[model samples]
Target: MAIDELLDEHEQSERVREWLRRNGSALILGIALGLAAIGGWQWWQRHQANQQSQAAGDYQAAVDAIQANDKSAAGKVQALPEGIFRTLAQLELAKSQVKASQNEAAIGTLRAIRTSDQALTAIVNERLARVLIDAKQADAALKLVATGDSLATLEVRGDAQLALGQREQARDSYNKALLKAEVGTPQRRLLELKLTEAGGTPPKTESQS
Candidate 1:
């Protein structure tokens, strides 16, 4: 409508264009960085999934080897990355080793499964103590079972104590095992016999009533 008004509007449009030109590179760079971050996160997720899949396959192979009585299962398990699957594979390998009478190798395999899980550690310790007792390393077996709270570990500790001629300690350990074991189980009966052999009276059973 007026020349002055049109001139003012033109100046404002040029100023806006000038501002966009000055900051356009920064805007583009910000968009590029955001896209790169998203892409990197996706890549990491895929990488983790692949790693987990590979670990699972390796663990399953180790399990099959153990079931088939293949001695190389232990080496296959040892090659897996540290995780729950790896721990289980190692346990299977140790079981096979023990069955095959490779006590020294089994001990080493069981010892390497030290995880942060207290329950898992207890299980490993129980197996290791049993092997040590069979190997006639009574002192080592006793030490391994010192913190053990399971019935099996307690019985093994009693056996170790008996081997070392500590009848009183053996009696105490057997009694503890009897308390933890079920009333009528064969394990309870065996613990009772062990207690009697250690010069302690067998605990009263439900059948004694």
Candidate 2:
């Protein structure tokens, strides 16, 4: 009986060894594939980090150029990747252009900042409208600021409407601007003056909660 049991154990061991010999290569291949997948993911993460770092450096350089009042500030900004930083750089460049009496160039620069962000779009539109108004393109300015809700945007719209001799629309826009502006602030005072110009009275200030 002892000899029979030893033979049985030996048979079972041989069967296990045979199974491993048949399947070992497949198991090794699966482990290799998993390791390759992990390596690929790590490489992608590193690549993305490097790209972001480079973009940040380029954006900072453009900002520094603008601050230094470099004549090439716009060129530096134009070379940046399309993003918020690029949009801000363009705005700074447009301001510089306006200061240099380059109204047409400033209008073109401001119009180029077409970001998908709502806040950024609003800011760009407000700036573009102001430039248009300055250029005596009141119709274009009115179209740009027509849907805006902010105090500054409303003021620009009012300015445009007034320029077009649309006194009633200008009065409504100035009133809206006054409502959005902070009480006792210079902006509110200006809005009040505009409202008066449009033949409307300023509303009494309410406490902001």
Candidate 3:
């Protein structure tokens, strides 16, 4: 090689070595941090999987306890960490309480359910409203269902209206609910009965109209 070319090569090599000497620690730290992050993420995923499994097992145990008529079933359900399973368990507990003529307790349990899930919220509200109505707190039932437009909520609102002697409001609520309930379903059948009780005629089907 020419002397100038060799000198340029040597200069380039020295510059690279100097740069490495300056940045070697930072590069190594960056790689270490990257590896640590990966390891932490893997550990988190495993921990989450384990927690989900435990929650599932606890929920199943609660269900079994409830089915066996164990008095401690509610406590078992209540012990579940908050999640979908806990919310469902609370629903089951509320159902059992309502069946056992524990309307007040059922209301309390239903009210305690906290979730960001829209569907679960509707279900909880419907159940809570029904329990409130059964407890002769129709006003509270109506208030609980006031902002909800789901089929279940509307039906329960109608029941609450009927309880409050607001036949016209009950008829309107049931009519709105009937619009959403599918034909030939038990829900539609129940709405029809409720409509009749409120002296409201079912709207004509499309074919009839």
Clashing residue pairs found in predicted model 3:
none
Cα lDDT tens digits for candidate 3, 46-71 = 99999999999999999888878798
Better of 2 and 3 by TM-score: 3
Question: Candidate 1 lDDT (Cα, whole model)?
Answer: 0.88
Q: RMSD in angstroms, all models?
A: 3.6, 3.4, 1.7
Best of the candidates, TM-score: 3
Worst ten in a row by lDDT for model 1: 69-78
Ranking by TM-score: 3, 2, 1
lDDT of each: 0.88, 0.88, 0.92
Every model's TM-score: 0.80, 0.84, 0.92
Clashes of each: 0, 0, 0
On lDDT, the leading prediction is: 3
Give the per-residue lDDT digits (tens) of candidate 2, residues 41-153.
99999998998899889888988887888877888999998988799889888887788888899999998886999998888888888888889999998998889688888
